[model samples]
Target: MIDEQIFLSEQTQDIYPSRYSNSPHMIPRADPVVYGSDFSNAPIHRELIEQYQQQGFLVLDNVFSDDEVLMFQQELNRLSQDDALKQCDEVITEKNSGDVRSVFRIHELSPVFSQLASDFRTMELARFLLGDQVYIHQSRLNYKPGYRGREFYWHSDFETWHVEDGMPRMRALSMSITLTENFYHNGPLMLIPGSHHTFVSCVGETPAEHYRQSLKRQEYGVPDDRSLEQLIDEGGIVSAIGKPGSLIIFDCNVMHGSNGNITPFPRSNVFMVYNAMSNKVAEPFCSQKPRPEYICSRKNIRTL
Candidate 1:
């Protein structure tokens, strides 16, 4: 059941309405970009905070050392070789090649990922930005294998989370750690500088069991060309390219996506989402059955 508080409260109902599934709509963002004000416990400084506020995304290089990257990389290789993981429903494979595309609930799949999720640098930044205790809304390892890798179409994550997972607001953020160097030619993540300020009500109804297909190539909840053009025209596009161990922090509602990685260099990264504890998920606003536990955790919610 949808939380009564979320349905009736002022915070969830009309402030950031989306899906339009019936009729599309667009509105300026209602939520603040920088949710937390106090920086005493913040791992980053004021300039970075302001940058996050103004641009809606920030990239930091050398967040993890080479040794750490190597360890995680090896772990990923191990997970890839484990035939059991390959057959699990949590694993999504590429469209054509059948190579692994993504593995969800990574923290639960391996202790190495568990440690990375709770690492001071990533978690502290999430807490500092959210101004409250936080928890992992979702965790995954995204892979764009060398040639024939697929593209993740442009879309706001909150759009899907709100409609499918029952998240009420945009008090969430994403931490993407680069395990392999993200080169400009190898389908790096791209984002509009200030597009997070716009709420794009995507045109599409939530199909039953959509996550099965959406994880590989998202079709629904995707913004239209007209809407995307307006955003790109205003904020412009920037490719987040960096060496291994780079970290990307972006607003939950930011407009971003990546292209197909046909280059010989494959792109892989660790993705963790942190949501403010105050904004716990309830019943999905779209009325679909809640996504599986691996995708969005509602029961036994734990503060990180």
Candidate 2:
């Protein structure tokens, strides 16, 4: 279970109630507009844009090489066995009995991760999706052990919690990179397309509760207690199953979340969130703050 106290920190400023717009239902839809007109001249194929516009997400196969994945995975496993990582008791949480889940802020822990966080291929794709000047706001590794466990509640990363008119575009895109193969049987990610544009008030609630309510409001017909598998069969939901080197990049507004690992092996992955660096925003919502330099130094790095 997520610690409720963490929500009260000032660093989590981007997450708060809005004074400008009423609840999601009351806010009028902005005029329907096609994106990617002026900002990025780089030839992002029409299909890629269409995919994001229609589904709120897109998958890139084999973004990392097999050797790279193996190296990163080895490094992560090594870190897991280290006393330093184990001593980060504050960031670690327990679920479903004694199964401990470690949430490591990768940029601070691993050089490889920090280098990859600002990698060119990633930044260029981000620039295409968002605009120029992307700042990596957060990076974390979730290590979920194999076994029976409480599911990770479904929720959006950008939902407001405390401040009014939260920072605009503070988090524009989030990239989830699977360190290991995330097959359907191992609790892969499941998301509802086009749910990003629909705002939901999820303050003070667990992810599971927020997800259930969102589905009901959307009339998606997903039962509150249904497993992710059950929801997928009903239609529209997509499971992001891929090889270890693949990645799924989606807008922060997207409604995305995952379940617990039921397979005998552990399910592990690293998540990195990037935001377009602009002056229109205030402080972020989470206590995991990034340095000002890190935010300002982003350059366009493209890989062919």
lDDT of 2: 0.56
* Per-candidate RMSD, Å: 2.9, 9.8
lDDT per residue for candidate 1 within 1-304, as digits (tens), equals 4787665676545565666566667788877888778777568989999999988899999989999999989988888888988989778887777888788889878899999989999998998898889999999998778877777899999888888898888889999999988888999999988998988988868888889888877888999898999999999999999999999999999999998888989899999999999989988877579999989988957888
lDDT of 2 at 77: 77
Could you tell me every candidate's TM-score relative to the true structure?
Answer: 0.95, 0.70
lDDT values, one for every candidate: 0.87, 0.56
Residue 211, model 1: lDDT of: 90
Which stretches of candidate 1 lie above 4 Å from their native place? 1-8, 11-14, 21-23
Model 2 TM-score relative to the real fold: 0.70
